[model samples]
Target chain A: MDVRQLSEAVTEKTKVDTTARDVEKIISGLASSSHFWEIVCATQKPFSVVAEIIGALKEKGLVRVDQEGEITLTPQGQEFLKENFIAPRRDYTCPACEGRGIGLEKIKEWMQKFDELTVDRPKAIIDYDQGYITTASVMARVALMTERGDLEGKKLLVLGDDDLLSLAAGLTGMPKEIVVLEIDERLVNYINEKASMLSVPVKALKYDFRDKLPEQYVGYFDTFNTDPPETIEALEVCMTRGLSSLSGEGCAGYFGLTRTEASLKKWSQFQKMLLSKFKVAITDIIDNFNHYVNWDYLLGSIRDDYSFVQVKPKLNWYRSSMYRIETVSGFEKIENRPMPCELYVDEEALIYKPDKSR
Target chain B: MDVRQLSEAVTEKTKVDTTARDVEKIISGLASSSHFWEIVCATQKPFSVVAEIIGALKEKGLVRVDQEGEITLTPQGQEFLKENFIAPRRDYTCPACEGRGIGLEKIKEWMQKFDELTVDRPKAIIDYDQGYITTASVMARVALMTERGDLEGKKLLVLGDDDLLSLAAGLTGMPKEIVVLEIDERLVNYINEKASMLSVPVKALKYDFRDKLPEQYVGYFDTFNTDPPETIEALEVCMTRGLSSLSGEGCAGYFGLTRTEASLKKWSQFQKMLLSKFKVAITDIIDNFNHYVNWDYLLGSIRDDYSFVQVKPKLNWYRSSMYRIETVSGFEKIENRPMPCELYVDEEALIYKPDKSR
Candidate 1:
């Protein structure tokens, strides 16, 4: 019998016998079998050394080499090795939120600043140790577009191939075709393979997007969705291509980094680039796959008549509880009374409705 | 002129005149009015000190003290002190959860576990910073119970005269009479006064809950809610009384701290105390108002039939992806793949579904 068969036998019997001589005897018995040389070749070990190692492992009770020279793990051996031998080398931190988990809080604060932006519910962006892409991010994207009726048979192109955008494509139920253009050949093959298994007809293309798109596909898509890497020059090139390829009324959803004035300036430059092609309509800053990473969604229309593009901040957009109190009487005593008439030099400066009594 | 009027004048004119003397001239004109002395008295400041301080503030361009002692604010003055001034003090960090916002995350994880065991979404517990007795907290409690179909027409007896709970009674659409039992006579009066203004009828009783609930009101309520201070013995006693007063089919919810196995043994005596009185049908860890702090939710059900008790493990219940590989050998190169078979003998075994072809 072979090593695997002998191991199975020992496990089937009362318990795998772990004696050194017993394992050696089993190995010798298997060596005379018809497939003995093939098994030895597969293990890539010298026959005598393999025999000696098997015997030693058996004596230590790490493994049981049975009558057929088959090997199986002993419970103590498995536990001992697992506990003592292998240790995770790197500490896993959330990649998307940078382990801060403060993205949700930041999103809530941002919503308060703008009037037109509204989220359906509190969505969590989970970071599974090996880099996660959550369903919430996809659902949020779908919800936003669906609420505005933006995705009705539009041919959407996802420039960066990831589970997040793939799931978003599925959830959105729009985009006549989702063309996932991935630069890496291996990733493209993997995504295509997964798509086939999932029964989602996704076309994966391997091409470097930083350079010009293939001449064959220019102005070929309705919308562009990209989460570009954090390089200003690379982003500009990607944004330029994305905006140029869009049909007159198409919207380009770009995921860019946010947080300092420099990032905001980069985002503004992209907006200017879009305006050169189409009439700029509505602009929204949304939480990306990770809520902390803010992305800008710009919708432009060839015609000026679309209501979706004409969205504007509401009248009370700037009002906040921070300025609700008329006066801070002292650090300890915050007076919540109505603002006195004399408190405003210019009546038009009042953001909230004035109390008539005051 | 009073400091308040002077400050108001300063604030009103700051935009037009940025200099201190110009603002002081405006305040001086206002001080010439016959009502200046009356305004000073209303401000609750010593007249002499108020006048001297105004002059000092004017010299510093923090205020504008006019010839007649009236005051107005320059832009510089407004920057220095717009409404009132006080000595700066150190900011305090939240003692619980260490200001990291982990408290709510812990609570949500625990609550999901509780929900699984109880098959009920117990009202979310919120730590409203100062204490549980706040309007927002009460509103949140009532809203949660209402969502669970628990607060409709059932009488609610609030053990303490918390303003927020009283507000909840008024705002909750459920048609139920709310009774407030308070030990403090003044608090009882204040709640009654507010209840009357909102057109909600609430009866306040000067009684101690530590003693048995009044004999007249025994067995009269459907549910009891409390945000009592953290004391294990006190919670046990209150829970006993609350359970006793609950209707035969009614349920009781209690919130408190969670204990790990190591710490739980020390509180084993309390477990026995709870088990003796009520059948703790479900124990859930919940997120209070703060999502980071894990709070234990003990849901005890009163029944005439068999008693049931369940302890739920804290789980971070968020959506995650699960992969099922059809053929393990095809994906063996993948780092996270589960091994198809064990080679070592007698290892704490995972039953392998061997490849039929192999």
Candidate 2:
């Protein structure tokens, strides 16, 4: 009956850190939602931790599982939540910006132009683990960049081009130069062709991150942007390349990290790398800022088997938190070293699958 | 005439890191506003760095300074920004949340109730270097806490409550228990009286952060919030005491940090402590999230003589970014050992005077 006693039981049963507050939070999450992903979203906890918490709750007779893996709190659980006075969370986030301070309204014209340019863009290739965010997201990103004083009159290096971010930055006519390094030759050629046609002044080069950055571009950029693969190896490469390109302290970098692909442990490691290894001060991390469109390959991909996909999400639930970090004193450069072969798939990967043929 | 050449000259003159991008950003900042504080906000750079950059630009004949320390671009600087297409940053942030992604609309009713409760609250004491934020800021903070799943049915601790955050949070009727540790007895009495009359479960104890945390409350909280003094010593104490109160991994902490009082070096130190020392993952850092009302003692304070205060800021420019950090596997508990006597005064002390009589 006591929440702390129940929390202790859950913690002991699962061998995971579960606080008295977490027990109530899980119960509150179940009041409106019965699916695993919904609970995860409501609690904002890691997938593994949520799984453990649910398992422990079920064992305690606080919740019951239905035929489709949907979970609902029992009458006993509801009574406990009421006794504790825990209310279900209400959606209070700004609908216009989705809790991101900058909206797409200011960049409406740019989004229209960008939409037209990406009409025939190449589909996300599984081999490269490529998935691009929406055009409105790209414009919002550009707006954020300008707001942070990172966009205007800066040499920007886009570590990948699947997102076509170089074109978006170039469209502002603000950055002095916009360069993109992408392994996909098709994307490189397409971006180059588009840039040349629109006179956006973007240069897209075919470059794999596994290789060392070219000598000419070392410490050449004022800012770098990347949406690296979720694997630890890919993170290291993207970070190293991005750090190596930044000129000095006060230079900035932007990247996107997703909870769907990277666990809280991975997020911790990424933060450690930024703070301890590179010595950059993370200035801003806006959650769910980058929303990805459902890729065409989702139906046949390994993600189809994910528990959350029992009923395909009707909304765009695939999102990444956008991170903006600035150098303080200086940064330590990480070299491009040989990495493990498996950079596309990790234990927590939900949407990405390995290309066996490659 | 070349921007890169000018940037190199500025670097040589200032003996500080300066990039072409910074040069352009400074020029662009001047295109809109001429005051030093306005430029600092516009560029989002460090105080010392902005001072050095502006001095270098003035020496290079790029900007002209008037008697009141207001700066404007010279004709050459204007021409350079125009030729480089460095547009002045436009105000595109959401007016509702001020770009924090959460607005005050949902909490409007709560704000009115909170407003009535604090009608006769004690004014901030200069001896403690205390200043309170707006009521809307407090509510937005509570909303953000709920959004992050940190509030409901939780044992919450307010480390320093000059802002009376305990009352605002108590108004929600969500937190299981609200405990405030404040050195200001007037504030403690005021908060306790309000909470008691409203049937809100809150307890305020007069406790200074310099002393060790009481044994009974250590590791007994689900969340802790604080707005510490700007000095490094205060930061460590607040962090240590807050960490000591957290139950275990997955527990969260919230705090406010400002650029007006802390430089980029201090910001870097704070990040390293969170990531390297305590090993916590910073989840969200919303810039300019907490706006403070101007204090009553500004006329006689040392800040009155600051370069940016010459014009007497017409708007509320004092603000701090809100940080939400979650524990990873575990955190290294920092002991609240003896701290330095001068926790209120530092090299960047802008708003807080040392109170020599003490």
Candidate 3:
């Protein structure tokens, strides 16, 4: 079975509505002889496409592939594809594009461009694992916004394409416009495509915030949310610039990093700087694994130059689990709720909607 | 009221036994009129000595000074001291000896000698502020130790001359012997003097721990307490080598730096390395300031670092104030126990007797 066959199978089974070209590019990428299993493991693609792709490869008689086994492209199969197949052209896959929407690729490209301008040049050191596990942490911010009635008809600008922010936008479902400023174009496109597919009104903007922001967007957003940049200086600048762009009595929700002494110090400094401009009403340090995941990989990806010494007395799991948040001016904390146990539940369980009437 | 009269007054008032030489050195240092106030501010000396020394200068008509003031030495007094007194005795008066104890000059020389030996060369980065706070933290540690029944007649070996460790030795009053290892011979001598003054049973040992420890003391200590060097590699080597020298089931209490992401990674690696030998237990990350200072400093000195960040949300004070402690391996956690509060009072309130009879 080939990409065409896999696409046909997915369309029949899931009604996902994807073109044969799109399926071909995705499958061919997966079927590349060099470490195909790793690609399958890393990509968060739906299960149907994954199964169909694998099934097609096995059925072709060109390769003996196991359905319940790890997928690897055989040498003969690799040669057959190279000789006979015309490689499907790769198009920017917009996550916000639902069912072949117009301008999906354009939006994806725009977000990609923005991400190139923003995240690619300088990597933000983030604990994606912690962010993955601490899913309930975002609820604190959302609750605050809801209590203040800021979510209704409010233009919320989410800076960074991390899953937390995307999930947050999907859950809250109140912001008049949820604009995502992302550094990875592919991620922006992916999120856009997902949002479009799900009928979530989230827009992806690809822009490097390090440089001066576009004048057209000045004062365009009312509320801002950011996962702080890695460097202390960059974080400070991001906070200042992000907050400065807010209109009216707007506030920014900072997913401030608070793990290491250095990060804590930076957060403290950022807080101090922000306190001068806005009034902080609520601050919490909580532990909720649903909000974050892949902590080991996140910490490893960020290059830390400072040398630290470790003293192993005993493992105190409770103390290490907590994280903190501070609510800025014009926002009031609604409640202190415990983290939900099932974080990776489907979108239906997690999507939050404020009052329908703006 | 010249230097002689002022010396006599101090001796009469405090009944602190001080030789004429000690009085003269202190008085002259104060009356030198060259950045005298800065020196007085920097040195951790008694206010009485500073007052008397200034009083003597005024009485002698050596200089006109302000009593209701931060002491300032006049130019006339400075010139007289430089030409007639300071130059001749500059070499004799040790710079390290601040007259209160062996001065900075002696300590510097001792540090130089310590450097010559290829041992304990990479000293731990001791944050003076954190160390100041640790004096109370150690008290809290003692409270925990008492609760654990780990503090009876056990031989407690203190590897560094930390003020907290010294105070812990004094307050517990149950250790078989408290041996303090200090690389600086002068500091060891000074600490010995302080211990004697306090009537604390502390034995000061001048030794570089990077090299092999003296065989006479090998495996002699039951409980090892030290703020170990901070680097993971150094800490691992130190803990392995130092803890190995302990008797069976003997525990070592190490107070060093807190964990960061890098430190956590390093610690995880260190734990893996030590898993074959030691069964680790007990870890606490205490963040409350009240857990480190009495009401005085908690309200005063610590007010400098506390402030709000308006961007991130704060935890609701009532709902979020409670913190949890869980059992990791061998020990059960005390319930409803808040983070250590009343650092000075509650920590010392518990009486500890180590199970030496076992």
Complex DockQ per candidate: 0.02, 0.54, 0.00
Displacement of the residue A110 alpha carbon in candidate 3, Å: 29
Candidate 2 Cα outliers beyond 4 Å, as residue runs: A1-27, A35-40, A45-72, A83-86, A299-308, A332-341, A350-358, B1-26, B46-71, B80-86, B303-308, B332-341, B350-358
**Per-prediction TM-score to the true structure, in the order listed:** 0.26, 0.88, 0.28
- lDDT for each candidate structure: 0.36, 0.76, 0.39
- DockQ, candidate 1, comes to 0.02
Q: Rank the candidates by TM-score, best first.
A: 2, 3, 1
Task: Give residue B224's lDDT in candidate 1 (0 to 100).
Answer: 62
Instruction: Looking at model 3 chain B, report the run of 10 residues with the lowest lDDT sum.
Output: B315-324
Candidate 3 lDDT over B1-358, as tens digits, reads: 2444555676565333222333444445554323333322222123234344555665566556443333444666667555533321111111122111112232343233322321322222222112233222334344433322234445666666534355455544645567777666655776676667657677788865565555655666656665444345555555554554554332445444322111122333433343333443222222221121212211132111112101111211100011111111121111211122111111100111011121
Worst 10 residues of 2 chain B by lDDT: B302-311
> Per-residue lDDT of A1-358 in model 1, one digit per residue for the tens?
1333444344343122222222332333233321332323222222333334444446667656445434555775456434432211111122332222223332332234221221232222211101123333434344333322234354666675543355345433444566777655655676576557556556778866555665545656645666543234554555555555554322334343322112222333433333332332222332122322211111121112222212332211110000000001110111122221231121211111123332
lDDT of 3 by residue, A203-319 (tens): 887865565555655566656666553444555556554555565222334444422212122333443444443433112232211123323333233212211101111211111
Q: Give me the candidate number with maximum lDDT.
A: 2
lDDT of candidate 2 over A1-358, digit per residue (tens): 6667765665564444455656666777888788776676656554444666677677778888876667888988777677867777666687777677886677789899889878999998777888889887888999888877788878899998799999888877878898899989999999999899889778999987877888788888889999988867778778888988888767889999887666565687778776667767788888878877767776466433334334444556567889998876545555645444456656555444423343
Error of 2 at A237 (Å): 1.9
**Candidate 3 wrongly placed segments (more than 4 Å):** A1-148, A250-252, A261-267, A277-282, A285-291, A295-358, B1-358
Question: Of the candidates shown, which would achieve the greatest TM-score relative to the real structure?
Answer: 2
